[model samples]
Target: MIACGLLLLCFSRKQYVGKVLVALGFILLVISSYEGISGRILRSLESQYSPINLSQVMAPGGSATIQDSVKWIVVLTSGIAGDATLPYQLQVSHHSRVRLIEGIRLHRMLPGSKIILTGGTGFDGSPEATTMSRVAEELGVSRADMVLEVESRDTKDHPLY
Candidate 1:
């Protein structure tokens, strides 16, 4: 939408404004197409978290080493494609899929841990948590081990409920 608005302004009768809009639109197009911009942004956010060793966590002696204080494994939902025709896994966004995989892995490693899938229905009216739970079930995480927090529409609501 921004791109279209800028492009329209670029073709306007005001020559000076059009020229400036053209330049701004070109810059916006370049930034939008450049994957590195988004990569760096995501990297900056991910860098805040300490890395986890799944191998050590899944080892025979590893279960005894985990902190007892850590109980629930929370997997925050991203957007879903909302395509019923697609497979459950394919319906989830890339980021959400990765998060679900990691959550499932953690749930398997931690014997008594339960996974909390958090997300509400998006604009499509299909609950994100439902999609996530379907995929998790397909991946072998039992329903008994999962908790669906389907009321959270966004990040702000996730922590609250």
Candidate 2:
């Protein structure tokens, strides 16, 4: 749109306006692509989360122990691969896998807490929660300890369900 507008302005003999628009667009493009600026924005958002102390949660024997009031470890699905030929564990996306792993870690640290996995069938045609459940099961999380809220297609739907 900016390019088309600039071209139209140039053809209309408004060279000054066209040049200014082109310069402004170039500056915006450069600013948007700058890694340092984007990285700082991401870091600022991530900093809102409280830091986790794994040493306090994991016992000397490498088992997780609970001492918190958390009753539910909710894991929101990130994404999934649609390929049915692959194993269920391999079907989860990298981001989703990381989230599931963190959820599992927290679950292990909270004894008697239940895991609530939420996601519906996305564009890829598989329910993310189902795939996450399979991975959690493979990691030794009992079936009774997990709940599948599989009707949620997005975060907005999660709270409603």
Candidate 3:
């Protein structure tokens, strides 16, 4: 950025007044990234929560086999768009319907376990609970077993999930 600004100093020289433009560009990038703010919030919230195993989270890295004897099967809501299906969508997203399917199958542990969907924000800036609700219903998750908490976009913060 400093180099680019110096180049722009074709008008004069990049350090028109003590590298002011370069400093300004860096500040803009930092502000636009929202880097520290969101990261700090997430880190604090994560640390506050009692740590659970990867199996506890629906994240892709774990292979823990959830047994049918388990009475409660809570799953994090997959935040990907429900209406999408294409190569690009799959390529770009770590969230998949397959994870939901697995969660549902694992959740069919007798009549006690329930499903919890935990995300509620959309790319279009709309609320997302309705989409999760629709998918649960479509997948034949018992309406009674399905619990929706549309208020939070963070699954880790959602207790049910």
Candidate 4:
């Protein structure tokens, strides 16, 4: 829409219509992408919850947290590049990297916990979970402590797999 408006404004005789379209398109784009607006909407729709404090939750011996039954930390992957030329760390999406890192952190703190990395061979033909696993290993997590769910296509499929 923005591109159409710009083209009409530059090359067509309907300059006034083009200007109106350009203004509307810009306004819509800004409104859709603005974090403050989205945050306000989310704040209205979601319930507030207490944030977790590791210091208070984890046992003093670094063995188990207060929730001794907790055994798995699931980390869902967003996506990854299929390009073989790129290193595993470079192929993982930034969001996936952050999530994997946090999962690894939790795994370390919880001792017996395993990190379940989830994703599938998406459009790029690269299993997102495999890429996450390689990066997790590079970050010092043992392969034995990580389970890769590499058949899920998206967030909805992650739990199913």
Q: Which candidate has the top score in lDDT?
A: 4
Question: Candidate 3 — which pairs collide?
Answer: none
Between candidates 1 and 3, the lDDT winner: 1
lDDT of 4 at 33: 82
Quote each prediction's TM-score: 0.76, 0.73, 0.45, 0.74
Candidate 2 regions exceeding 4 Å error are 1-35, 52-68
RMSD vs true structure, all candidates = 3.7, 4.1, 9.4, 4.8
Per-residue error for 37 in candidate 2, Å, reads: 3.1
Number of the top TM-score candidate: 1
Per-residue lDDT of 1-161 in model 2, one digit per residue for the tens? 36955895868777777877888888888897899988898889999997778677767876665555557888898888888888988888898898898989778776878999999987677688988899999999999999999899889998877
**Alpha-carbon deviation at 42 in model 2, angstroms:** 0.8
How many pairs of residues in model 2 come into backbone collision? 0
- Candidate 4, pairs of clashing residues: none
Tens-place lDDT digits, model 1, residues 1-161: 44555666666666666667668777877896778988888889999997876655554767636546457999999899967888888889999999999898778777888999999997679899999999999999999999999999899999988
Candidate 3 local lDDT, 43-102, one digit each (tens): 888898874353653435433344334556555555654344433233223453655666
The TM-score between candidate 4 and the true structure equals 0.74
